[model samples]
Target: MMAILIAMVFKLPVDSGERNGFALTVLLAYAVYLSIISENIPSTSVSVCYLSLYLAFVLFLAAMSVVLTIFVLRAHYGTGEIPKLLKILFNCTSRSKVDVEILEKTDVGEYEHEENKLTWQIVAVGMDTVFFYVYVVLISVVTSVLTVAYIIHYRSI
Candidate 1:
């Protein structure tokens, strides 16, 4: 997904100001990978530091992605036509009344805010739910074995 988004930025030939948007998107991709490694901080003191840094990085990446998305949208379709675009998006849904309400409620700021919020919510909840159901349920009985090994090795001096 990050690759696809970055490709799109290049495809659009983003302006000088917007070009950093693409770079930042790529950087965020790396940040996520780095975060995964940092998640294993075993030392109690550095653990909090690593966790705090990871959270900050995640938030920064999220904000960067939102800004990049807005820049992409503006470059792709100009803000003037967003109402019509939103109307089309709304109409495509099954509920007409709900669609009108959506269209009515979405200006650039609101649209971006809601869109980013929903995207993150969906990703966080979806991954967590899937992990719990698909992985945790299947492996729950054996988790104690793995947990004990990890604690014995990583949590011990």
Candidate 2:
């Protein structure tokens, strides 16, 4: 089903940049869904089939977006090591730009710098998780409301 496909696509091994790209794609898809619905609506009554389709479409979009957002959050915050296959697929080489001599010269300083960087990364991951959950909840609520309204309208007709 569409939901399964969306979930699998989100789960695909990729770097942070690629994951962000997928998130943007989800947003674009939701926009397209909205445009399609707006174009179909008119002052006159709409068909049951059309309403039903709209409900299904919005629900699908909502589900995809919600699941995708969760995956994004996990990718950003989860402490799991990246798989070797994923590193290869993403073309990630374990090469550091820092000079070995410089690292050796400032061993204590380098450790402090690393600790600071880790703290900042944790804070960033926390913020991203909160933002993603808020976005997903808002979109899901809006889509659910629209779907319910459409169902009520269809029933009344």
Best by lDDT: 2
| Candidate 1, residue 4: lDDT | 35
Off by over 4 Å in 2: 1-15, 43-118
Model 1 C-alpha lDDT versus the unseen true structure: 0.44
Candidate 2 C-alpha lDDT tens digits along 1-157: 2223333334444344465556556556656766787676774665444544544664565555556556545655667556556445333322122223234656776666663232222333333444445545554665577778878877999
RMSD of each: 13.8, 13.5
Q: lDDT of each structure?
A: 0.44, 0.49
**lDDT tens string, model 1, 1-157?**
3323433433333344565565566667656755775676565663344334434544454445555545444544343333555444433542333334445766866665564232322222232233224333333433455457657767787
What value of lDDT does candidate 2 attain over all alpha carbons?
Answer: 0.49
In model 2, what lDDT does residue 135 have? 48
Off by over 4 Å in 1: 1-12, 15-28, 50-55, 79-157
lDDT of 1 at 119: 30
TM-score of candidate 2 against the unseen true structure: 0.39
